[model samples]
Target: MEIKHNPQLTSTELATLWNTYMADSMGRCILTHFKQTVEDQYIAEIIDTALQIAKNHIDTITELFHEEKIPIPQGFGVNDLNNNAPRLFGDLFYLRYIEHMGRTGLTTYALAKAISSRKDIRELYKLWYNQTEKMFDMAIDLALENGTLVKPPYIDYPKEVQFVENDKFLGHFFGKKRSLLAIEITHLGTNIEVCNVGQTILLGFSQVANSNELRQFFYRGAKIGKKQISTFLGILKDNNTSYPSTWDSLITDSLESPFSDKLMLFQANLLSAIAMADYGTAIGGSVRKDIGVIYARLMAELANYAEDGAKYMIKERWLEKPPQTHDRYKLINRKD
Candidate 1:
């Protein structure tokens, strides 16, 4: 199909492009900083690929916005990064960071494609989806090669096929409970690993944050991350499964600010939103009543934390507004 750019972009198309551009810009800044500090060649290559994609995506989005006569968002840039600063984390952190980010990018881009109607918007999101999948694969391979990837617990194969005959299939709240399914275990392990990665990065952010309030926010995020990680691990232990190891010890004692506070806070907020959404999914996929309740409670906590982070961003005037329709009422009531 010969695709032509529509003179006007739909709201969905506009929002998707605007969000992707802002996110890619922030990602580029962070990856650029990581590029300067990463010592491993394999990890560096992955970051390089991701960084190039982000830069190219930002440029394309900028041109699209300009053609549409829409003002471009002032996203993060080199000024938001300090490449000469001391390394705040070890090489392992960068690898795991990419792993977490790649997962998010795949999810976001797919959803963007689904909601987009314009040919240009659909094609761009599809391209991003494929690109992010490759990036995710690289992250997983590098992590496995480095022995840093968290292995999910193994389960015994069923001796014979069986069908659920009673309510016990859903779960038991009072009596003895059936063992967790492998799928359930996979989601739990993945969420736990994500929290672990977030905690480690937040710990490093807390050390380098310049604003006292932002630093406190990072500390709060770390504390919540620690709690969530333990909660998931406890659930796994209840089923006699081995929990993944922590990566917190990989962070150094460097107090230098390698990233601007705006970049750091935006990242923290972004991860918090992603964590809450994943927890909701884990809850839905879970059969255990107790685990679902746990996810619900944890999501509430994360929602509250994310709200506070947004307020801080607005207070600091650092949050950029996304695209919206013009106010007809305001225009009609305007004073000359």
Candidate 2:
């Protein structure tokens, strides 16, 4: 992709580039480990593709930052990776992880493209978004072939076009409620799967974390994720709808840390942030008042979890500050 000369990057463009750089850098470290640890040839190929994409994004973002005279973030790298550590996740988990990440990348890059005014930046995001779409398709295809993908529950086809006749369709507080709407079921099933993934990842992190404090934090996160999964699952059970299978059983008993404490903490917090966003989306898509209420409550818990993780990162000096405007008040107070 050729870069056209333009004015200084807009705040939204800078924010999106900086965020993508940080995520991809961290992803590079994690994917490097996955590529090294994976045994299956087909899975290894997918991991390699993901790792290359991460590295390419990091390089492109660094180049853009240099051109714009913005300092690059000190994102994760070889120093934060443990090449000798044993694998913490099973081969199947790698596929699932890639699929999940690719799914997220599509959303992130689409939004980045939408908010960007610079032609070069918009094109970059569009390119990456397409790449992610292909990557996600690959993962999904393989998962389907392996019979590892847990699909959303199917609902009977509507026999005819029907209109709501009563306000009760919105759900009731005391009496018999209506069956789950397709959108409601979709969000509930998706959130349950995300929680399961978070729970398993945190469980692996907790086992290998070096600091006791970090270990406890990861354990607590895993426990909360497990509870959230159960809550969603219970809702599905009420409708007799099936949900995705849990990934906890796929975690290994490895005690050796594959990633630094800082990296692990960042990843855990990132997952929590994603969960909160997912819940908010769910709340919006849902029509049932009770379902929305449940999502709202979960969002609050996830917010607290993410905040604590941010504080911990700050305390440890592991959090890298993003680009921001100069403080006008500080400038005004300057004596020189």
Candidate 3:
């Protein structure tokens, strides 16, 4: 296990590094603007730490990409941010944003570390995972301290571990459907939480975006997010469970552009992608037919939305070129 081979990067390893770099680049620009406009000193410190972590990862990943001879992605940077623009969101929302991002980071790095092959890449992801985990913890602490943290629903402790007795465990299309399993509740709660965060961000983005097309795209995404939130909340209410807190009121009325249209579109697209992944995971985890079917529909909607967002990005030439396979046909037909 100690042996280190400088072998060609596997597709999975390459993907994990490449994707992280792209997301991290966006995070760097976002947090930079956040750090500039933030008024609360406590929230400022957390933003600074997050910005530092994102910057470090971008630097490290760029080096790795260069060594592997893979083309670096044209991710966001100084040109994508306008820090002098008025604040689009308040301090509380900034902290809440960090909290949502921390949770996503933990999940992302964990998956990346699991799939990485090369020793160096695995080690790198592990380092990022540890750092991201720390950030999650700090965000949680800050959210709790600031009274912004939303805990999942509280259910009574089960009497004992009991197996499913019959077909009723999966529920039905007729009368008297079975109740939700604890695991099902967990996944539902998780999706709702992340969806709310997505909705909140989309709302703010739709408000201050400069380009009309970008504004429309964000508005469309926000509408989808709102519907998704309603679906999740209705499910919880039907099953008699508490819902998580909403930060929709945290947004400001500022119409000034804080981020470039490119940055805004990319962020919207990135979060929608993550939301799609989250729904897929939820479908896999839920055993209930209804839950799975609902998530499948939600995932489909997200896919369509993402496709539109990608086309918009392409039209605007904001889409970054990722590392891809060589064109064998083109090489064979070359005039040279």
Ranking by TM-score: 2, 3, 1
Query: For every model shown, what is its TM-score relative to the native structure?
Result: 0.94, 0.96, 0.95
> Which is superior by lDDT, 1 or 2?
2
Which scores greater on TM-score, model 2 or model 3? 2
- Per-residue C-alpha lDDT of model 2 across residues 1-336, encoded as one tens digit per residue: 665678779999999898899889989989988988998888888888888888889999999899888898999988999999989998888898898888789889999999998898888998899888888888898889888897877888889989999988889666677889888999888888888788888989999999999999999999999899999988888888766666544788889999999999989988988888889899999998898988989899988988999999999999999889999999999999
Clashing pairs in 2: none
Clashing pairs in 3: none
| Shift of residue 232 alpha carbon in model 3, Å | 0.7
Q: Give the alpha carbon lDDT tens digit for every residue of 284-336 in model 1.
A: 79988878888999999999998998898899899898888799999999999
Q: What digit string (tens of lDDT, one per residue) describes model 3 on residues 50-158?
A: 9999999999988877987878788888898887888887887788778888888888888888887777878888888888888878888987887878888778998
lDDT score for residue 332 of model 2? 98
lDDT of each: 0.87, 0.88, 0.83
lDDT value, residue 313 of candidate 2: 96
